[model samples]
Target: MIFMNMIFVDREKELQTLMQRLNSPTFELVIVYGRRRIGKTSLILRAISGRNDSVYYYATERNNLERFREVAQRKFPEVRYAREDWESLLHFLRDKVVIIDEFPYLIEEDKSILSTFQRIVDENRDSRTKLILLGSSISVMEDVLSYRSPLYGRRTASLKVGELKFRDLRHLGFSVEEAVKIYGFAGGVPMYLTRVTPPFLDWVNRELKRVDSFLRDEVDFLLRYEFREIGTYKEILRAISMGKNTLAEIRDYVKVGGEISSYIKKLERIELVTREVPVTESVRSKMGRYVIRDNFTNFWFRFVYPNLSLIEEGTYEITEGEYANYLGHVFERICREYVRDRYRVKKVGRQWWKDVEIDVMGLGNVKVAGECKWSEDVNPHSVLANLERKVERLGHTVDRYVVFARSFSTKEKMEKAELVDINDLNSWFMS
Candidate 1:
């Protein structure tokens, strides 16, 4: 199972946009950002794979401008520099492809870097350079392009890199069950998926629970980069992961007297947290609930964050005990992805109201009511009975009914109800 390949799975759209800009005859100042390990660096590298005119420099807090200048001088020895400074370096690379990754590091080291970039973009308007400024700090990058920032109105293209789809996990050469286990933790992040192997539980114990591990500080690193106030965001995320999803529930959990709607709005904008309304309800429905949406982060907060002392004491059983419950939600997301494209399901989501909740509500040309069972040994008849009751309470008739489970003893066929087990999902999804 190769997970570190170059842009093979679900990045074709982003790669196309980048290649189109890179091959153009005009200047391009593109701003690209996403959370860490989302493959922003890999996409850019693959875009300039065979191009001999590209220079990729990763900036750091230690100040790498000198190293970047040295690299420019070494890469293009023909360009003469009158003074050894940023202006000369920009002039030297103005006609070539340049990528400065982790642009926020420079911004942190010096506030004037943004202004310097604005000057570079302005001075090289007619130059044929494709200069892309990339970073993992979503807020900082978006702020750079805001109307009040120095680099505002100078970017020709902007992109926020996103996670791969659940369907793309089939190509990783794993069995259907193993694929689900991988998705349960990695959540389609290429960097995280690269650490997957046989015996998924062992991998979890070794990588995720190890002291002084990268996974231990992963969430903290992200929070530090993204927000000035980390305590509030962490509390909010922990609250959401623990089923305190409603606005009132979250506020009560966090014990905040003021409003948390603005904090949640910022998180939603950065693709960390998502608010979901029932499919049958309007977009402005007040019955919406928030969800972390990222499987890795949710798993971290649910099992790891609360049990930090237990993890340090080397007592892994308590953390591992609740993992199955966590995978229940993961399996629901997988089933949602399965039916999202079927039955002409242009949009698929969960449906919930006061007294009833449907696991999967697929809306399109044909509406589908679905239920997902993560554990292999689930009673299909009882599950179907519950789903029918919810659909009844939903007060609307669906065009089709389907049930998803890990493995079922009977995939008994029926006109109104379809039972799709693990083998069925494997056959239908594996390419």
Candidate 2:
């Protein structure tokens, strides 16, 4: 139904690159991919917009060659294709720019599509034809670039479009708090953010938990298309979203424990979940935790998926009843992102040693330790004091202490630490 709001914020670098490719004298092979609803198609369309000379064809599951002919006819009605095969059709557009969205669909339908593209790209190395391919399936798109694939090492340029950050939501005209609270649920997915309306809680009730909601079916649509074992992946996502982060913890939470590592590896490959070690620790550290990096994905498993019955009966009255706890976790991510965004941090992530867990840590020229509180009326002094105690347990010297909260009990400044409230964050958002 094309429900995306289509505000088309950000993607300046990607847009610039795409525009630059159009001017290149040689043949251009561009690959753009990301998870669904991440604006890959939008970016391409914007690049090719207002240019009748270019052909933008969406390849479908069945009769993609026929569909290709139909779209090509719109652009070149007077020209006739010599043959019905993809090679003959694509060769017809040799001097033109052709973009095939959802190229993975064509790949699934015909396994020989890779060789077709490889032959075209090889036969047109010196030609000025620009071929841009895009896909929503991470694994399949990545495979096209793999050493084992026929089209490997052929792309002139590639871009993995990602989610927007909390700071990037300023165009919505919401207060900093409102944007951040919305980010806690919607994350940075533009599709979900566009559905957010006034009266935040009401938007949550209407847009999130409803049976017919696009978001309600989003995760399933994504997983079903990407993975073969959807049930196993969902259980793992639910386990991680519920705080079963450790391998052992996730293994215990999800009973079908054949090889949790392989499943987790697939999720990591897709960028749906991440395995994080303490900022100060090595990548191979045993204390690694698998965290869902996507806010909307986590929201689905944590709240929406588990409460389907309530949605089915249309009696889902409560919205964000337990959202505070979720935000408690989300606020940590916000502070960590802020530290990385605002400060020159060589390392930025959470740190934990046994029972002592620091919410945010940024190690650049100086080690900065931060405590994030999603509650009201925070005491910076006490938070810093407690944070100091926790930092001491790690046997390290922290050059500064920073506290981020919804609101502070006092504005009194300290020489060693800085207190940042929603207003402070809002200023950063604007900056």
Q: Using TM-score, give the best candidate's number.
A: 2
For residues 345-392, could you state the per-residue lDDT of candidate 2 as single tens digits?
Answer: 888999999999999999998789999998889988889999999999
Candidate 1 lDDT, 53-150, residue by residue in tens: 98899998875787787677677875445366566688877779999999998899878988888888888999998899999998888898899999
Runs of candidate 2 with Cα error greater than 4 angstroms are 1-7, 319-321
Error of model 2, residue 83, in angstroms: 0.4
Q: What lDDT does the true structure give each of the candidates?
A: 0.83, 0.85
